[model samples]
Target: MARTEFPAKATHAQTRAHNASLVLRALYDLGPISRAAIARLTGLTRTSVGELVAELEQDGLAQEVGRGPSTGGKAPTLVSLIDDARHMVTLDLGERTFTAALLNLRGEIQRRATRNLDGADGDAAVALVHDLIDELLAGPHSPILGIGVGTPGIVDSEGTIRWAVNLSWTDLPLGKRLAAHYNLPTVVANDSRAAAFATFLFEGEDRPTNLIAIKVGHGIGAGLVLDGQLFDGDGFGAGEIGHIVIEPDGAPCHCGRFGCLETVASVPAILRRAFFQAAESGVRIPQSIEAIAAAAAAGDELALGVVRAAGRALGMAVASLTGALDVRRIVVLGSATVLGEPWFEAIRDEARRRTLATLARDTEVVNGGPADDAVLLGTCALLLTRELGLTVRR
Candidate 1:
């Protein structure tokens, strides 16, 4: 006999909840929207939209802001998001440091703090994050809605960090632990992906849809936002391009790989090369990327060589991505890109030379600078989306 398939429980109820979330998000994005306008935008029945809006208003996620002009009869009262209804805490966990912030409903940071962590041990990291949140909440603020964390690695669907070589984390239940500590809705996402979302929140209006955001720092990673949505693969590690092998046996990487892009294109990689060259030539090597950039700006051949070599590696990686993803715009963020236009020009020239004519013609490369607040901002967005139920479809 054939195996019997069980029907999904309360499909209609889940659908309604999802649709209600859509309605709320629509109002949040396009504020002061009329019920009729929401119905027209979301394609839900007028009655369904009305019911959802009433429910949202009752929940204090939304409110009637003002009246809208009517074409025929009585003007309708406009509805918008209650920007001060609640708050969220966002944690930006990087390989070297962590930044925490409290964001309000309008996605504005109310309070922020930064600290450097020794390593990415799950327990120690959690303790540090909890203490930071406690300190931030001690200030004058409203009730918190939830917490969001952005880390570097492959985050599973259940929020388990599969692997973060930079942080030395593996199979860590970060999301569960944070939620348990705060007893609030929590979310964990890839740092690059979060950065992509933050970029969209900050500059989506000016950028194109088929865009590639390359984050070059201690580690080299890319975040692809296609069709205005963060794209993650089945393993939730779509943009783990840092580990992509540029040379089969180049330099050793933390991921136990050789010649990965990060091993050659990251800030540390450039510093290592500089130090090696300086040692061989009996010259003092610059200590940091900033110092190196300063030296290069002063016509230091050694500094220029370091920057140019890393730029070539980065350009090759970008060229590969441009060919594969066929993205038109590439936004590079981190210390290396800020090393001045020479480094960027090297990468851009190589990419244009190697990429197809059509791809090169369409591509526009620009430096995004160091995303000092991107991670925190993205974490805030994650919490806001959960608490207020805002999403792209809505």
Candidate 2:
């Protein structure tokens, strides 16, 4: 057995911050209500809730909206979150392009910009990030909250990038450099983990406390949110499942391993399979994933076969993750998800067949489809937690 070190005892300041967060969370979820209602919902004393709300008002985070109907006497006053009080600069460093967005406190993008990296690397790649930020900062936005970045790689707690093969970056102190240069708070995290937090924070009131969100595109990765917090393994690679050697004798991975999960289940893998099929049949190769999905939907046997093969590969990985973590909510999102129903069915079937009947029967695996702005929103969630000591409940 190993020794387990518990967290340090929280100080009075920590307690106050936690209670204040509870109050803010209540307003975020069920806003425009009375201070009394927030106190009741959070189980905090009215005095504490009132003081916190006053502080928030002074900070321009909460404001009086209107009045609510009274239960028996005079109507009660309502307080609401100032969703646009602060703006967050968010970035999603994608495989081929880096996208930057200015979003309000509610995670709604106000302005957007993108830069085509086009194989930029090293210092050039880092410069592109600064360029995008400079454009956003020059635009029209009020008090800024700092910068939030979601990129591809194994990121440590302090935002050091261990490796990102395509970007040709290794052990990059990205967070520290950005913070020092920009003179604003900065948060950097693995894109997959960022997407996982976005999914969790936006999942509404009845959502589960734990989830596994798998992003499959040019590469494949899964982020584990356990007990409402990200669980980065001791090596800070907990979600690097894409490189797991699922096929000991399969094709070589960029990570120098053979038959890794990415070689079989990622978008690149599916496209490669499609190209082979098209070549064998003397048909034009799919120009994009949508083309393959279209052909499969039209009952093209070859296209369906290729799609199913990739789905089954992903399902195997999902089964392994579900068994190890026992997290029942699994969400699949990314470019490959465009394969839609046929692809999703194969994933679901293979996962159920491989996992225990009792576990599989109750498990719910859903397709989230497309990456969209998930990474951008997730990094913002991290920034909010770090800067305001509040979680993004909505």
Candidate 3:
């Protein structure tokens, strides 16, 4: 039997923070609501709700929007969140490019900037990240709430990058460094986990209690959301599925592994396979994923084969995930979604074939189509959840 460890008891400050978060969450989700209604919804006392609302008003996070309809004797004053009360600077350190954006409390991007990495690595890549942030911050924006980053790597909770093979980063204290430099709270997380949270939050009113979001691009990885919370394992590497070995005697991976999932299902992997097949068949060597997708759509056997093979690889991964976690909702996103229907069909077929019949029947794999901004938005989600307590579940 396994032993279970419980969390530390909440101190007075922690209790206050948690209560404040609950009250604020009520307003954020069901705002333009009266104090009595918030009290009822959150199960907090009316006095506590009032005090928290006053604090929020003083902080410019909430304000009396209007009066609600009279339920009986008199109309009650309604309070709502000031969606733009704070600004979040978010970054998506993509494989080929780095994107930064200024967003409001509602996760609406007010301004954006991009820097093509152009094969930069190590300190050079870090410099580009700084450049993008500096450019974005120079513009007009609301009061800075914090900085959030979605990067490719295994990241610890303290915002340290344990390793990011492509960027040649190892044991980097990126979050701490950024926080010290900017004098603001900072969160650094693996891109896939961030994307998973973004997907869960993007579901809005229909957000599920459990979901698995897989990002397939230059690398393959996933983020797991369980019980309405992002689940980071003991080492904060819960979703580092990209390095999972799929083929023992296959292509070499940057992580010094052979036949990792990324080697088969990632964008570069798909492209490599497609290019080789195109050349072997004496067809036009494809230059991009879009070109291969177009060819596949037009009934090119070679292109279809490449796309299906990649999807099949991903599907096998999905099967293992669902089999272990039993999460029914699986969202696939990133540069690879352009593979389209044939690719998706292959994924579904393989997942169904590999998974137990009962589990396969309920598993739904959907493309998060053209989620080009998912990483950026995901970072914003992290910031909002951590800094503002907007997405906390009771």
Candidate 4:
């Protein structure tokens, strides 16, 4: 028997929508540009561009900026996107707090609000999210376009949080719940994946579409963007690297494992080691990542040694990524990045030592230095693409 197949087709509306998005993209990337320039760039008919521009103007998304210099004829009027035509609400659910913000179309923060979770679990934590959103919405803003959420743990593409140990959530339909209660478009994604997308979108132009962003806070995970698209893997665990065992005989992890990357490379790991070292040296234990960073900055040999060890652990993961994926761009984010230059040097050194000479030579391991709002902006990016068919440009 022959294999069954179905023919694919696009309806007239679908074609028009796709073309409209193309026109918008051209205007966003190259405007203040003339209609003729947009037509030339997008390969759409001049008539079609005119109609689309008029529609966009009527919808308050695009407007004429000014006239361009004459090209041996009459000067052309330029049009540009109304960067604030729409607003999106974004949230980042962190270990100790939940932060929310109002953002413009360009992913610029308009206003922000936060609430401390304080180890709140179950219903209380969920309510805290609602409280933050309500507070932001109650501010001087109306007609919100949608909502975006960045959280920890496994998140299905359908926006279900399969499991978040810290948040006390399991198989929670957070996306659906938010959308229904607020009656707005909602998107949810893992924090690392969202950070990866944010790095890919905002890292400037003429760059490769593939990049990896590793979030090393209390946990360590990575997000991969391949060919300008987020690859969630078959099980939605594409970037779940924190739990991978690096030292099988080392200390036990909370996930019931021994010597996982999270046990050595994460912020908690560094702090734990710092405390132990302090106990041995009869020195006061540093209480936070910031304090340890400050100590390292003051040339504390003990603190620097602990940071170097953690950085080396992280570099092992980088070597794995470079050797396997050969992705040249690796961005490290979260509070752990505050360990500063010494930590970064150790990471780069180990990654180069472990990977192929040529691959390591071309790889650029960038420290993003605690992009606190990356999750919010990344979910906003995801929302703009999935809901509005638009790419965010700064």
| Local distance difference test, each candidate | 0.81, 0.91, 0.89, 0.90
Candidate with top lDDT is 2
lDDT of 1 at 155: 90
Q: Report the C-alpha lDDT of model 3 over 1-394, residue by residue, as the tens digit.
A: 9887555664666878888998888888888899999999989899989999999899999999889999888999999989888898999998898989998887888999999998999999999888988998899977899999999999999999999989999999999999999999999999999988888888867778999999988888899999988899998888788988888898999889899999998999999998888788888899999998999999988898899998888888999999999999999998889989999999999999999999999999999986887888888888877786676221
Residue lDDT tens for model 1, 290-321: 99899988989998888888888888888888
Largest TM-score belongs to which candidate? 4
Off by over 4 Å in 1: 1-12, 39-51, 66-76, 119-122, 279-284, 383-394
Q: Which stretches of candidate 2 lie over 4 Å from their true place?
A: 1-19, 39-51, 71-74
Candidates ranked, most accurate by TM-score first: 4, 3, 2, 1
Clashing residue pairs in candidate 4 are none
TM-score versus the correct structure, for each prediction: 0.87, 0.91, 0.92, 0.93
Model 1 C-alpha lDDT versus the unseen true structure: 0.81
Residue-level lDDT tens digits of model 2 in 123-200? 899999999999999999978888999999899989999998878899999999999998889999999999999998
lDDT of 4 by residue, 151-237 (tens): 898999888999887788989999999999999999999999998999888888765778999998988889999998998999898
Steric clash pairs (candidate 3): none
Could you tell me the TM-score of candidate 2?
Answer: 0.91
**Worst lDDT window (10 residues) for model 4?**
4-13
From the highest lDDT down, the ranking of the candidates is: 2, 4, 3, 1
